[model samples]
Target: MRNLRQILLEEIPEFKAKGEAFLKGELGKMDFKKVSGGFGVYAHRDGKHFMIRLRILSGVLGKEQLVAICNLAERYAVPMIHLTTRQAIQFHKLSLDNICKVMEEGLEYNLYTRGAGGNYPRNVAMSPLAGLMKEEAFDVVPYAMAANAYFLQRINTYHLPRKLKVSFTSDKADGSQATVQDMGFVATLKDNKPYFKLYLGGGLGRNPRKGIPVDRLLPAEEALYALEAMVQFFTHEGDYEHHHKARVRYIADRMGDEAFVNCFWKYFETAKVKGGLDFSPEMPKYTKVGKTVEINHIAITSQKQEGLYSYYFHPLGGQLDYRLLRKISNLIEPMTDVHVRLSMGEGLYLVHLDGEEVQQVAEALDADNYLLGVEQTRSCIGVPICQMGILESQKALKAIVDYFKAKGNIKKSLPPIYISGCPNSCGVHQIAGIGLVGNKKKIDGVLTGIYDVYMKGKCTVGETHLGELIGEVQEDQLPGFLYDLASKIEATHQSFDQYMEANKEEVEQLLSK
Candidate 1:
């Protein structure tokens, strides 16, 4: 009954021994991929380099960890760090010769990359503001951390039919996009005791799905048990024979919801009897204090804990310079007790700061073009790097941002606009208000990159639906199109959400013209 993860872990030492030979091509690519992927090292599109994704549990990292990551980027990988949507740090443009060194260095800082890339459970995601926000139903960090610890080295969770993503949301802000995960834990309070509403079988990518509720409320303490059973069910029953239909969602779809749950309980019954999953319930440690006062009109920046403040800094296109990151880390680590939280939106959130410290941080970052309302525009690593990309999504995002700034008509609080270089939706285009998925079409008798534009997509409490494709626009025409759309919205609607709700036909008409 050994799972793929257990087998891989047992075989890692053998792969590590061949690392030098693999780098020199004395070994085969297939063998390298098998072992490297199990260790979270992925071959880049160029086939000569690699990318290593680190598992920063729940996107939480200490100052020392940040310094270690920056050091690794400088020494072995790309000069900059790439932040993923799932809140993990990716070190790209690495050589196989250096990857093992990177992995060994990570151990010194207590960071890990194993299971970060494989079908094994990826890094667990949680609301970045879980412990800091006053509006949270309950702080879900403890549960998130516990869940991560449980699955981190467990052989059963290392590999699955496909990647299983787990997220814990503090409240309906749903920053973790729990509804769209393989497993989601939405926090709730039952008679002042913490509980979670369980969601299962949700995912995005080629075949997107919103998870259905498995339990309205499961006692929070039993989360590990439920997860263990769910993992067992997927491990034993999932469609391993077909790679395309390997996700747990496929199983749920084929078996029907009632049947899926029935099958789940059979596994659950066994896991319950086996025991050892139960743990002492310790409440989340952080306390939210004081009222938040906005600084610079950026909603992500706020004052919490009386005099202390929090600031969210977005590195445009999720690229952060290693030296700058190290500088920022040094400045804050010495002065405050705050641990940095990497947001799902691909930004950094620094909490527990005094007014003077906040001012100093802001002044230091004023020159970096650190975006004020970066959530307005997002993009994926596109053409030039990503093997699957059809267009330059990051450059396109920069163009759109510049266009809006020049026009001076677009609101800072505009709905999220996502641009993906392909249908893979790494930029989360499907969940955006204005989404653009990259593709190519014949223009002037030549193939040119373009975007299939979408509108009205949402991933919120009352409304959870993917964006509907409205039209296509040439890459050169996108900035103008966005400018015109912003102007139209400014002239009529109070918000982008309101505009989308009322002007679907009008938008279609605009696109036609």
Candidate 2:
């Protein structure tokens, strides 16, 4: 039986054809949810407007596409572009009448918004530094792009048990958070041939689980086939009767590891017989897409590939000023081939730049404080825009940054922190060194906002683990506590993970109480 979302997806073209009348509140409540969510248009909690999420697969976007998004937002919504945890762009507070126009306008730039929401394969993420990073095993962009393109082609028509999350990682050290994905591909080299380590059934949001390894080594050629098999297994075996337990993770949880693995193998063997899908091993090479500028002096993060350097710009909680982005886009327009990657951390990365162009890039971005790194922290857009939001997390993130600055530790190296407005994990709190998910507690008979704390999460090439919850902190108490926590940790250890390993009991006693 087709899911309600798939049924809705099939009818969207017709709804879109009756665009004006449909937008004018002609559809019923259930029909509205189906028609809107199927096309990535979500009603704001207030029900007065909608939000459209764009599918920015592979976390990369071109200047033309960026400008198109800005134009759409400026003309219709609040003129602000939101960057989501999945590395996609979102437009908020848009009216129903303007959604199709915005989506249609985006189509001109080859930017599509379909399958960005609902029970479908959403954006496929990979390490934003894929080909440009020096430490990567090999470029995984080709594979990531191939998977994204393949899925998007079928997303509009395919009915899934629930949303499927997919990811790929080229670098183990900075492993694209692949362990939390429904299906993950980690790059490896075996016998001088590119291969991948496959992981399955990992996810966060109410029930968090790290992906279990399916294979130690899978030939690169079999990637697409393996992906197909996984989807097939999920479609047939996943629990559709209970919406809450429809994800692949729940299915794996219900069946023990041995049973789940055995079932997956059956699908895998069948797919293997069907043969490998088309794949390319070539890496993208950018050779000056635009003009070039000379640089006298400017320091960037690091030189990845001799003569090419990368720098990151953050847009506080992923809310980018469309006007500023346009300026930055124009600034790098000279280096036409330079890749602009939308990082999962909600930052923008300018990659593959000539050493000489660094000064001009820095100067252009410096005027507006865009070069500051405070936005490095991951945060989710909070209430009341998000239907599930429990706290205004972005505001809390700003408070943390301000506290760091006041203590003169703004630039100090601390553990990676992630803030989610609720348990949905939109901020990826599960994998953070120190994670905070907002909640409310009754204090003195009054409900007060607080954050549930998670500590000791780890993500690497071979393993990914969700952090353990220590306790909760009152909203008013968070800044001071975080400062003390950072100071105490800095005094004892070089890294938070190391500190946790050495003083688990002591730390737990200190925080949980």
Candidate 3:
């Protein structure tokens, strides 16, 4: 694993020069993007402000790290601290000068931003509740972190056709969305020993695909061999000429699932023979005990260990209030073993807390909390923030939640929504229950913002599937359509998926309206 000291001395200083040049206009927007992304910094749509993504491996954050993040937000006067669907956190609306400073200072807290973006491996995702889930096969966070450590250093020099995504899930819950990653491992056991069920070639975004099963039982120690093999395979066979056709999913699609699996094994075998790829990684074992608290709320869940609990707090749309977090940090500062993990849906979990600590945090949320709804949705930083964005995805989500929540019909029958400003899938809308992709339509011979509506998409384990494009709705009409569709589902007393199945014609009519 690469240390903070080495990155600070070597990679970061090199990036500083490029950042300086970009600020001075010595580097063009397109030209600077080629270098800035590797450092986790990118030019905003405005080209004046920048955003930096922090590599929070496995989405886990210690108290000290949390403190530093809060401090940095205060120091930078950042209005919002954004938690991503990919389980990473970002600081947006920063000046180019401050972007570089945050990257260097953030490393002091081990919140390294290096290799957080670009055409390299992304942060290794794991179930936010991996260790705490009552039904998990075993803790999977350690192995996920191990994979993260292995990839962290290589991303500095390793070039690829496109980015690689990997994940680990403790059980079938698959909260990490393993079925939609370039690679994934689900915790399992054989003859009373730990093993991993592997999946490969899955991906989201333009031409999204569900991964195929590659191995049923792989020993825990040999997991890294698969990682090494995949890097070798993608680097060797990936298409360099076609920008959009270079992903692993495209390769798998062209070669067929069976052929892809067969070819991967050859690389895996070669990797094992190549040596120096085996190691053991262990999860943290919590040992504090307290009184059991009855779980009556959707946010509060019981951990596998008696007398311990975890609290789910979704700062509506994952745009955590900068002010609220400072207060939350103060509340947890005196607690023990209370760490936070970001959920795949852009929520967060405060785990390893005892009854008293959990209640304290719960009370804090009750006093001043972000509201939730089936429209408790998440979206990418769109428009002025994201250079690739076509619409204001964040604004769209807020309008939906604000419109629906006021109707006083927040229920599970209406599935949570996901919105992507564009088709790039940064919002992961392809796997949402109900999704919207930002688009443009010619209205009265002039361009107008619109959204492509999709329904019945899901991320269920072993049954994951992409959402189908149904129709388009003008941005202004989206909230009304969602409200009408959700009301239809509620009237029929069926879930969103069930309603879509039973009332396909009615659904289409509503979208057309």
Candidate 4:
């Protein structure tokens, strides 16, 4: 990790110079992007401001890391720190003057931003409650953490077909989305020994695909071997010339299912012979780290640790108010073993706390968790910030929340709601609950915003499936349609999936109308 930090630090001067050239109009947009993506820096649509993503490995942000981020946010006058659906924090509206500084300072805490945006191995995601989930086969935090280190150390291996994403989930729920990553490891147990079922090449986006199993339970110790194999396989078989068909999923498609499996296995064997990647890290030690006032308003859940709990919160649309996070930092900074883990769904969990600590922290940073089922929506920072975005997805998320708040006591057992600005699935709209992809249509000459609706998708271990596209609805009509449907689901007293199963015709009628 120290080596990775030093490597990232050494590259800053060059990046700064290139950034300056771009600012001076000496670098074209595409040329600058080619240089900037590897550095995890992006200029705002205005071309004056910038934003940088800090990849928190396995979604763990220690107290030191959070405090450092807070200081930077304050130093930059950043009103909000955006949380991405992939478990990273982004500081928006940075200037070229401070963007490089932000990158350098982040390395002080060993938080690497390099390789975050490029066609490199992105953040290694994991179950936000990895060690804490009671149903997990075993704690996968250590292994996932090891893989993060392994990848960061070798990130200099450039020019993959596209960005590679890997994930580990401690249980079948696939909370970290192991079933939908380029290379996935879902923890399992055989005779009380921890193992992982490998899923390969599944991802969300324009041509979404569910990961294919390698047909065997991988020994937990050999997790890194599997990951390294993916790197090799992707490198060898990936289509370098075509941009759209470069992802690992495309390799699987081009090679055919059986051949893809066989080729990946051969690479896996080669990785094993090459050796040196043994992974058996000690589980993270949590010194029994609380009060009991009211952390249970909605966001609190118990950890596997007997008395310890984890508190959760979502700042609607994942735009965390810097002030709220600052307050939380102040509360947890002095405390031991308390840390934050950003969930893949734009929410976060405060772990290693007892009941007392939970209440203390919750009281200090007041928040209203979105109405559990139907109200909460995860969205990408679309339009202005994203070069690929087609809509203001965050504003759309806020609209959904505002609509529900205005309708008092509207109950729902709905699944997760995901909104993406476009078909790229940054908002993870392909799996689970209700999915919305922004679109536009010109009726006469007036262009109007609308959303392509998808429903009844699942992302659990054995049940992974893409969301079904039902129909398109005008953006303005979205809230009403959802509210009306949710009211009916509530009357049925069934979960969204269960209700949909029994009332498919009725649900489709509602959606169509």
For lDDT, the strongest prediction is 4
lDDT by residue (tens digit), candidate 4, 155-268: 766778889999999988899998999999999889998899999989999899999987878999999998889998999999999988999999989888789988998999
| Over 4 Å off, model 1 | 1-34, 155-157, 287-304, 372-375, 406-413, 443-445
Q: Model 1, range 1-513, lDDT digits (tens) per residue?
A: 134334544555665666556667787766666666657787666767777888899999888898888788777647657877888888777777677677766766767777786578778899987877777788888889888888875733355877778999987878888878888889889999888887788787777777777755788888888889888888898888897788888888999978887787788789989988875567755453434344663523553346667777778888877887887788787755777888887777777766667777777775663555433477877877776689999889888878777766445545778888999888888888888999998978999988899887777543578888889888888888777777787788568878877987887776766
Error of 2 at 95 (Å): 1.4
Q: What ranking of all candidate models by TM-score puts the best one first?
A: 3, 4, 1, 2
Q: In TM-score terms, which candidate is top? A: 3
* Residue range with the least summed lDDT across 10 consecutive positions in model 2: 290-299
The digit string of per-residue lDDT tens for model 3 on 61-174 reads: 888998898888888888677889988889888887677778878877888777788788989999999988888888887788889988876667779988899999987878
lDDT of 2 by residue, 1-513 (tens): 134334434555665654444456666545566666667877776766678888887888876787777677767755567888787888888766677677766666766677788888878899988877777777898898888877866766768888898999998864467877898898888878898887788888889888888755888877888788888999999887887789998978999777887888789889878875747657676564332444433235554566666767766677766687778777877774675787787777787776666666776775544223333677888787777689989889888878878877764435768899999999999888889999998989999999998987777867567888988888877877777766777788567677777877776566554
lDDT, model 3: 0.83
lDDT of 1 at 206: 70
Which regions in candidate 3 have their CA more than 4 angstroms from the true location? Answer: 1-4, 367-371
In model 4, the clashing pairs are 290-356, 290-357, 291-355, 291-356, 291-357, 292-356
TM-score against native, each model: 0.90, 0.89, 0.96, 0.95
| Alpha carbon deviation, residue 209, candidate 4 (Å) | 0.4
Clashes in predicted model 2: 3
